[model samples]
Target: MSAGDIILIPNRSDNYIYLLRCAKSGVTAVIDPGDAAPVIDELEKRGWQLDIILNTHHHNDHVGGNAELKEKYGAKIIGPTAEADKIGGLDVTVAEGDTVKVGELEASIYDVPGHTAGHIAFYFPAVSALFSGDSLFALGCGRLFEGTAEQMWHSLIKFRTLPVETRLYCGHEYTLNNARFALTIEPENTALQARVSAIETLRKANRPTIPSTIGEEIDTNPFLRADVPLVGKAMGMSGATAEIVFTEIRHRKDNF
Candidate 1:
């Protein structure tokens, strides 16, 4: 169930669209394509045809190429039904509790509405992979663009329930900036300090810091790890549950 080669096609300066290829199955899916040209280029270069187009939300940057790709390649476009009106050519409009298929592989759908009122994340249980569109990132969660802090908290909590090994594939490349903000909340977290060091190197080399695992994010990402007692205490909120601490950290990041 391991991913074969995850390709990163940099777009829009800092934005990146990732393509996942399964080795044994040759099943391929594009995650949050901001533009059609790069996706078309990559597929043509590999002599591959896109089988599925998985979207996290309906932002232009995320779904800009969805319509083109669907028409050109006949790829199945799967997105949250709550935004079905905006998710162009949506073949399968899903909600929480629904399961979507990519070839023989199945990804469980979660209605993670925080960044947008209808944002959805795809979690492939067999491969331990989660495709979280704009809703979640490496060290941060998306801003409260269309939902409340409480809604975002609930979405984050759902991801917290995933197995520690689940590998998370989010929609953007905002780790470096996110880590800086995280430091303001939990400056002493050793795990975060180490990740900061590693990510700095990755950034310096102009590499993409993505496909972050649920366990790795849980240990280092303040938005997801605020449940740790030490973290809860750092925010000047004693005895608050981890989710509450998590909520506070998100609020701070929003304004930071």
Candidate 2:
């Protein structure tokens, strides 16, 4: 079966709420609906029935609209089993390796706990779309609020193995700022420099700079380049382990 069509819905300052619709089955799922009004309105606009509420974590910004949407559409809420009690209205609790279907499409759940201990991500192999809530961003990674730098690094390593063509659908519109921080650590990276130029134009136009390909991120994101000699050298850790370089870079970004 083919994967569903996806749309990014801008929500609450910088967060993105993803909407996935199966063309063949006409089933629709809203991912990380921080707010209900916009989602409700959008469903009405498309005359689509909301069938699922897919959450990545327990953060209020990610699960705030759970009750409202569940009440409104009787949508089944699927969330991380680790945070089922924290995230209200969950109908299915999933963990790593478990799969959830969106109409004809199937998404594999991954435990990417770093941004939060219970944070997870959904990956649709058919579409190569990764709904990386707070764990991974375009040119950056998530802050260590509930988890540690070590945990975050390990979590990112899992993503490093995904196909280069995979598309990253992260939660925030933090690419512009992340690009600036990345340039500081890898000033001579031509790929990042080129991406920064393009990002500047997009920001000037008030456009989104996300849904970046995994290949693009591998070439540009400093976090994803921790193993590269230049990136490690930039942090004065040229001989350090990849994990060490990753930790240091994350520390710098924490203060950036």
Predicted candidate 2 versus true structure: per-residue lDDT over 1-256, tens digit per residue: 5557888888999999989988788889999999998888888888888999999999988888889999999999999999878987789999998999999879998898889998999998877899999999999999988998778888887888889999999999999999999998999899999999999999999999979998998898888888899888877787998888888999899999
lDDT of 1 by residue, 1-256 (tens): 4645567788887777878777667878887888999999999999878888988898999889888888898888888889999877888889999998766667889998888999999888766788888877999999888987778878887998999988877777899999888888789988888998888999999888987888888888887766678787888987997667767887788688
Global CA lDDT computed for model 1: 0.84
For each of the candidates, give the backbone clash count: 1, 0
Give the per-residue Cα lDDT of candidate 2 at 189: 90
lDDT over C-alpha atoms for residue 63 of model 1: 88
- In terms of TM-score, the best-performing candidate is 2
lDDT value for model 2: 0.90
Off by over 4 Å in 2: none
**By summed lDDT, which 10 consecutive residues of candidate 1 come out lowest?**
1-10
Clashes of 1: 1
Poorest stretch of ten by lDDT in candidate 2: 1-10
**Best by the lDDT measure:** 2
